[model samples]
Target: MNQYVALDNIRQELTLRTIPAITLWNRLEARPRTDNFDRALKAEVRDALWMLTKQWQMGEFRGDDAGSPVTSKIHMSTTKLSKYVAGNHDVQVFDDTVPLEAKAEQRPIPFTIDTQKVSLDIRLLMGRQWLKMIASTGNFKTAYVTKYAISIPDITDKNDVMVTAHREAWQQVAATAQRCMDGYELYIYLKSDAAHHAYDTIPMTPVQQDAIDILAGKFIIWYEKLYYQPLDPENNAWKPDFLEYQFGCSAPQGSGEKVLTADQYCDGHLDWYSVDIDPLSTTLGDTGVPVAPPKTYTRSFIPVPVTFDGMPDTRWWTFENGRTNFGNINPGTTDLGKLLLMEFGLVFANDWFLLPFTLDAGSIANIKGMSVTNVFGERYWIEAAGKGLDDDWNKWSMFTLNTKGNLGELTDPGLLVLPVTPKILESKPLEEIRFIRDETANMVWAIEHTVPLMTGASKRGSEAADELRKRYQQLLDKDISDGTVVSPVPVYKADIRYQVMNGVPENWIPFIPARMEGSNRSIRLQRAAMPRILNGDAAKPEKIRPRTTLLREGLDIDLCKPYFINEEEVPRAGTNVYQSYQRSRWYNGGVCTWLGIRKQTGRGEGHSGLAFDQTIPVKKAE
Candidate 1:
């Protein structure tokens, strides 16, 4: 009930005063300003000679016939993206410089199915780490250990019986990489180099080919920076939900009958291209207006002066930067963008400008306007400032790219893209997952929140589902202490009282929504599953499924298929996604690596009390 104010300079409680002054105004004394005449803070200007007679009666020192822009040019065009195509494969071509978000969410190596299929314990753990690093460099044995039925044993034996006699050479490189895998799609999809299913077959030698080139170069530094690529399992093509792209530009020399398109691009960069999408420009007819030519360019710069982050200082009695307070801007009489951003920071911060220019990581440009030139050899040809009516949201623009034009057409001009990328590093995630939304259990759970394991390391998804339910309760207590184990019996009939569907933990999984196939109202989400009653074959239960590979996409085409997901990409604030392992170097310094996938937006909706019909009644013993 007693707080006072003003006692700064580190006296902790600096300002509290909610009416606690209590009359303490101390400035008492026998005064001492016996007239020194320098009372400080007044600084001249009391109409300094009527401000120099109104700057010579208003001609304000005359000096404005315009003359600043020295040298500029611009006139761009560019194009390049060459071809890549996703979904139904077959179009590839961008030759080679890598990035389209690391070949579309990474993964050209590291195979362990998230439906990229390879798994048979990743082909016998890459053929038992290529026969334990070429049997610790001694007898590079490859006689298919007595031709296929496999049995080499003595690499000092007991490494799990030389890994169960090379389990038929890792089940023939995971069945020849599930019969030569392939897949492709834009914002997600990748599965191609299953390390050529271990030397395209035939028990190889050269020290099991240089110990699988040092274990496929450490699964190219940790499974492409840690797993992603999973989408096009028949997700069809041509903008399979647009990681966006549209290429094909023309119009120079008799306009090739007008049409030069190219910037319908999507927002996934780090050296752009939408990883693949070009099958003869797949559809959007009238051939999406383009005839092919565009390349021009033309540089020439020099116009500089425009700065940002809290600027305001073109003098008018300057000395005011108490943190950019153009007078605490209280704009609201129908704020016209805060009255044109405070009239361009108090009068067009010196008519702002910059120029910039460069363009070449994967090209796209299209400027078509500049010329400038000033110091009065006089030139003035400017034109590309948010031009107009592409549906004019008061003509605004920033990184450009939207293209297809259409809304009452004719505005067209905006192109940009660059695609540069190259700055890399990443790491931390190794599988996160989130994906909430529950509406009190109406579906969407995902939730693993870091799982990874199979010993490549990672934990806490409730400690890996309580160490997978204590190794399935020590394999149901070593099958009940091995007494001719026969615990499978449930045939009840007396009013059918035996319970069946009710278990959950393998990290919460579920998803649900449904409807999309011929849309009776277009719905999406899908994924679903949550039964895991630890299959002792109670007529095949086991559903839990997800240990993170971004929610195991489609469990290899069939554990009942259905994956889906698009219901406007999970709303009510939730979706996250994680994986990680980037690296980067290129342009000859080499070192690239991959495994990307990011996704964001979550911190909302959750409720895994995922239920189902059940019973809890047992009174006989009491």
Candidate 2:
């Protein structure tokens, strides 16, 4: 009976399972399985990851956070995901977000890079595309763009605006791509050019090179601030000496609004210290109110102008005791004035008196036989006689007086004056001969005293008379015999003479002539008569005025002699003799105050034969 019950239960269970099994079989027939499911899942995951990576790299994430973690709940469309999973290689991560079809036909436009404008067949990519910028130095950078289009504001119409905008947009894209490239060269991957999948490089234009150079200059300032020492007291070094740092658009002045594009600001302009930050309130602490530190600051340096004392004039005289107060006479007050004083001491502004002398006929005749006694008491015979007068007789009238003295007489007091003579007592015109002029005057009188007992009426048989007659005959042949009449016509003019004494006192500086103008004979006399100052034991003998021919129609004087001052030796005396000669030569003769300390002339040459301690009996002049 139990066995019969078990069989009935099994049959009932089998009958219920058969109906469900048939339903399952029908459902299985409706839907079949495929082998590519795992591959599809894997592809979907890969596509998702790629999209996430691209979004993160392009700064498209929330708050543009690249470090954000990737989660499974990222927003994605099923259709796009399916396309990637289906192995559609054309599927881009931004395919859905950006438009992929042309909204309108794009018209080509010319774009400027720096100063160059070029028309390119540039077209836009409707969808965002990836770009890789490879620097020449092997650095890599990436950027993304939705389209190649530029925006130009304030256009006349939408069409024109669109064209300009497209050009500008292209420039913006290209500039951004090239910003981090070495030398700022541009490299880009375009959607239109399918043959070049990799980034193609564009050479830098001149404008681009200039822009980079400016950028480099600015960057170096920052780099120096970080790595270099602005002031190192230990090494005695400092930053480059500059007045100030400037920051502004480097566009040329008046380039117009159109030329002042974005590229103009790449290089900064020069800044002057005049427009610097306020000196009274420079630092933030000094502002008294809280403020952020300036983004840029400048360092500047200014030097002070030099100041000095002036020089004395060439005609400025100082007594032997007056040298201690030389600082009293201010010299070289102005730039040009100082240069003149230093180069040519006190140039004569107007012609002035050179010596104290009268040019009248009686005075000229009186000085004929007189001797000029120098400070040394040495007598010099007066040789040729002439006079100078300007339009104003009272202001200027003097004689050209030549003297014949010993060779070594040009020391201490370098000048000679006719202090006392028999002719002076006879004429009784002035106390002393003084004041010489520039204009030449007639030779009034020369040595006309008859030779003692040697005139035409004297017996010619005596030996002394014969000798005197021979001399007189020789003088007559030369047309200059005493008593021979001559017209009162002007002969020769006089020029100033600069005589360098043999020995100069330690505290004394002689008056070196600046400009001397006259005949060659006058120039020679002026130069040859200069005393050569000696060093150690090498004493150079003073010059002596040679005996010249008597003046018949003109003054007879020597013309040849070495007159130039040696350049190497000129500086030792703190003067430029040759330059002085050149400048002073144009002026007529005049008396200039000899700026020197006068002293008694030494008489060593006259006493050379006497013993050092011996005294010689000398007869006094009556």
Candidate 3:
């Protein structure tokens, strides 16, 4: 068996360096260097350099202190005094998210799971030096008192000062408690603890439970005084503990009146009576039988000159000898004035009996059988007597004869019989022109007279009337696009007249001079050809011929003289000749066509016309 050494002994020998264990030590240290070692070392050096560079660039390590010092004083709790009073601490039993209900019910309440309950009070303390200063100053006293004298003891030591400070701070906290509790209230059942565990089990009626269930899951606040009741002393009746406690449910009342049912409320209170009842029964007695209404007749008679049978006659009539002069008649004293004078004469003559007529059964027969000649004779009779003739001359004569007698009644004793000349010309051109002008004027006057009536019939400033006025103005302005007017003149005459009479400026007319005829024709031709040229169909090869024969005659070959040409390799002949050469034996036989090169031998021939080398032996005529 080989001698064995213990591990502890070997470790001692190695530690003591007494054993020659260099090979073992070298074997233990001889690990092959892997790529990861270099990579790890490089990564460590990069990280260190990056950290150092970042620290230098940021200047974060240039501050005076490495860590901040604590400046606040530590508070020590004492078991002798209540922490609530000494620390001025208040415990909040309820927060805003807490659900408070008027009654208890089994319903899910979605209260916030992360509700935070914070203390209402915060600890406040003065420094020990400040407390000592207060002790030195002693308690403040009033200069004078009206009601009573007061005594204040001076502070002696730190304990007395501490006691006074604590007392004053507690007093201040107690004073602020009422203000803090102004809108706050806590409800408690008889058996409920400070955590309100018994509130969930309170007794509630079905209506109260239903109310709680209806308002469930809603974050709500309830005050204690609103629902709390106290026993009455006199009648032992329960009453509200606080009569003025306000419940904040401010919803509106129902729409219907309290005193009325739905139908009565809908019908309303006003009395209604039927309007179909007759009012005449009570107002008037049996004498109120409807009387036939009096007949209403329209006057229909106008004060204008009346023609035969009251018809408006436009026919112009002349007496046999009405006038002798040929000058233009005054328009004011023309036919209408004469007709008016004739009417006045007829009435006057009938009243004064200047002429007479006879009436009998034969006269009535003659009146009924009257002809145009008899009517004209009657008009002549009145004109000869220098009297006016009524439009109904026949009837007037018959009436005069029937009522007042005889053929001759003193025969115009007072009237003057002036010799009157008749108008010979009936249709003068100038008279017709004046008549047309008068008629047009009358029409225009009639239209203008109706404007006020039309405006009254329509609403004031209506669109219809405005459009009518606009169209009327356009008519007056003669707004025609085709160079025509209301009178429709010839186009050429109209153009000339419009240019001259309308004062049209020369610049306003788009004129092109006749001198540009050739250019304009060329432009038009080019315009007509543009589409064909753009479509690549300007002229077909078969239809078009070149203006110059240079290209066709191969004379345009001179145009290529500016380009460089190679002397060693000359170009071939024309395309047709080149193509023929390619098909012939010369090109196929590889003949050189270059300008300065010698021709080669044919395909079957050698360079010096020998079929093979002359030095080699050959059979002569074998």
Clashing pairs in 3: 321-420, 321-421, 322-421, 322-422, 323-421
* Cα RMSDs, all models: 27.1, 52.3, 68.4
Model 2 misplacement above 4 A: 1-622
Q: Runs in model 3 with CA error above 4 Å? A: 1-42, 46-51, 69-73, 76-622
Model 3 per-residue lDDT tens digits across residues 428-459:
11000000011211110000101111101211
> Candidate 1, residue 354: CA error in Å?
25
Query: Judged by TM-score relative to the true structure, which candidate is superior, 1 or 3?
Result: 1
Global Cα lDDT for candidate 2: 0.23
359, model 1: CA deviation in Å?
5.8
lDDT of 2 by residue, 376-475 (tens): 4454444322332212234322332222233322111111111111110011110110111111221111111111110111111133323323433343
TM-score of each: 0.31, 0.11, 0.10
Order by TM-score, highest first: 1, 2, 3
Cα lDDT of candidate 1 equals 0.53
Displacement of residue 50 (Cα, Å) in model 3 is 6.3
C-alpha positional error of residue 621 in candidate 2 after TM-score superposition, expressed in Å: 99
Count clashing residue pairs in model 1.
7
